[model samples]
Target: MSKKLRVAVIGCGAIAQRRHIPEYEVNENVELVAFADPVNERAQLYADKHNAKAYMDYEELLKEVEVDAVSVCTPNALHAPVAIAAAKAGAHVLVEKPMAVSTEEGTAMIEAARQNGVQLMVAHNQRYMPPHVKAKEILDSGRLGKVITFRTAFGHPGPEGWSVDGRNSWFFRKPEASMGAMGDLGVHKSDLIRHLLSDEVSEVGAFVGTIHKEGTDVDDNATCILRMRSGAIGTLTASWTYYKGGDNSTIIWCENGVLKIDTDPVDNVIVELTNGNVERYQVGAMATNEQQTHSGVVDAFVTHILEGTTPLVSGEEGLKSLQVILGAFESQATGKNVKLD
Candidate 1:
């Protein structure tokens, strides 16, 4: 058997603990080797639990250990720098979503990976889900016949309610992050709509509001309209105020039929044909890393490194989705349609 790839994880936060580490542990092609976090205790804890070395300084970890790949699980602001650093250290990179705070950062990370001749993949795990796979196959089958409209949403009570610590998390602070719903929840739907439709969003018009969570500097709710480059139109809504849950659903209307997937990733999907035919598919919820997003992404990355396969979610793919989210924020600010260049 080929040797297991040595993998290092930067930023041992809730995401690393919940998804990355556990997924890496189970993958036959990977051997978890090192961990780093600014918080020394968290790093130490993860190191002890995973039997890997830990460092508070990522550079220190990179310098001391030889790793085949690294996961940049740091805050949004640190993603680009860490990814660049990991690339320089001769490690392939797997960065968490939203890519970075700005397009420039995203571009820089991609360049670093290219210049270093290493693979760089963003964690857009939604594309790997069975339901999404089924949906994509259906859409590509021309069963959707020039899909004219696409709508997708992913929302919940808020990250604070789900994070390791409530109210004091970095997610609520702007310096540590950017738009709230736009980054936290909107990015998922943005990636999904683009992947399902297989088109780039050319323009966006949006409205963002902070109707709840007093004292938070970020918008908790966001809605937007999109015009695809292929002349398809769509709408996206992301929110953190859905106290009753049941978010993360999508509806697509095409010339031939309509397809709807309920909020839960694992559930019954409904499809309606223009000919008055309807079908239902029962899908079990998939285990997507820690946040139920995409553990398959981790496995895919490992396979890519071990066997020279292409990444399931490349940096370019992440940038396209980021474009949609950032365009939405731009539209929200300017109160007009923002064109994608």
Candidate 2:
């Protein structure tokens, strides 16, 4: 607890390369200890860059290296297994979003960390976005009154542009990804909306489908109508086929007016009230495939471990967001509203 936290990255793919690795390097409190990936070249590349040891198997890395924490950035299928092992190894865990592919798996991961007494945090970076942070502040300050409805969208050309392997990325493989855009993008917004409004999604009605992606059977588009426990209603859309560009914007309509977050070309948060008053804030830009920015996920994870504090997106929080998306999947299959218990 007094020295720099020894850390290992369990996956060396795009997310790790773009966010976790560089972020960890910036944190003086963390020591880059090791990396593991099924593809030795990928893991070795990052390990060599940071002068850390590399392992082809994460299990071996966890067993051999004395790491204090690990970032689980593997494919969706490996999240539970790797996180559980890290917990059992007495290492804190920072698993990427869509924590696991199933409710049972997520539950087990949470239990593992609980039993082991190690911090288990899911990397839901939207909470750290400048606009999102400001929006939460405004909402909590009672400036927005009460949110009535909202529409949030997250989209890009496809994961081909973001994934390291291009077209053949595990993102397109149904088995590896579990859910496509819904898992990749939808879950982010799900967690964000919940964070922003402090509300839990109670009912979900959705239309999920594989529209234009050629290499995958997983859904490429998801349009969901969510009713929260507070009786607030909203719509969420995630797509990999937004050919023009990415849209990471959310508009929350409240009793007073609408709070627009990341909608304007230059402004980060624009508050437009019914009284014809407008307030614009230029906080910071959100990261994209074209422009990589600092994601605060790693810093939070490290600080939580060092300070012995529960993370914002704890294992339980990640499971709740995952359940929202899973409910969307169920609604898509059954053509009925899927209620979260």
Candidate 3:
């Protein structure tokens, strides 16, 4: 580990620019070695910025380049294949969230990493946010008692605002994105609720719809009723139609009080106990679609790779959270609650 850890980013898109590249650039131990994207210019753009090699075909990049880590920022469908290939090539992988379209794919990615003795980390950045980290600490302290329920949401106008390609972004395509807002936004909350509460969703009932966006076949809005293994029930909503401002908030009602996060326009975390005591903490703000901030994912992934340790969001954790979203789809199609196995 004397030399800086060599890193490469697959799929030089908006996320690579906003989250991956910039964060890696700031990390003192990482050396960005290469970049790859389907679009040659996109790959070259980031490559030029970092003085790294560029490739259009990621497979070629893998075959020719030797790197210690790779950030898989490709479309949802490609997450598994690229990660598996990278793992087999002896590179630890930090893949984007909603790890894969299905559990089978996610499992394969995990297994590939396992067989190759490489770490597989998922980019579930919400858990790394200042407010969320503070929320977890408060909840873990048992100052609020056991969390009984929560109403969490992650919504924005749509991918057109954040995606590099605007409306032509792969986020609008079913084949590329797998699920729309749920995959894009909700999975973060799904993983967050599980992280803060330390529970798994056992059942799900959802209403997934393609409302508003006339051209897209994928859902633009999703509301899921989740039943955690601990018997805590709550609602999780993901939407691409919150036009006024982005909503990235979570309100957890515990046995003794309620904990509000990212809700107050001014405060970071709020505590309203049953005894009429109100406290506010100024942890920090969440990064909106219009803002560029450090996600903390790249640094964590690099650290895990260097230390040979498990990440906060490992591939298995990613698969379980992904199952919750997949269950939502099943529930939406059948109009009945889907119990995850």
Best by lDDT: 2
Please provide the root mean square deviation of candidate 1 (C-alpha atoms, Å): 1.9
- Tens digits of per-residue lDDT for model 1 on 110-179? 8999999999999887787777777787888897698878788877888777666567877788888776
Global lDDT of each candidate: 0.83, 0.94, 0.92
Runs in model 1 with CA error above 4 Å? 263-267, 286-294
C-alpha lDDT (0 to 100) for residue 52 of candidate 3? 89
- Please estimate how well model 2 matches the true structure, expressed as its whole-model Cα lDDT: 0.94
Per-residue C-alpha lDDT of model 3 across residues 218-280, encoded as one tens digit per residue: 899999999999999999999999988779999999999999998888899999999999999
Candidate 2 residue runs with Cα over 4 Å from true position: none
Name the better of 1 and 2 by TM-score. Answer: 2
| TM-scores for the candidates | 0.95, 0.98, 0.98
Better of 2 and 3 by lDDT: 2
RMSD of 2: 0.9
Model 2, span 1-341: residue lDDT tens? 45999999999999999999999999999899899998999888878888999999998999899999999999998899999999999999999989999999999999999999999999999999888999999999997798899999999999898899999999999889899999999999999999999999999999999999986899999999999998999999999999896799999999998999988889999999999999999999988889888989999999898889999999999999999999999999999999997
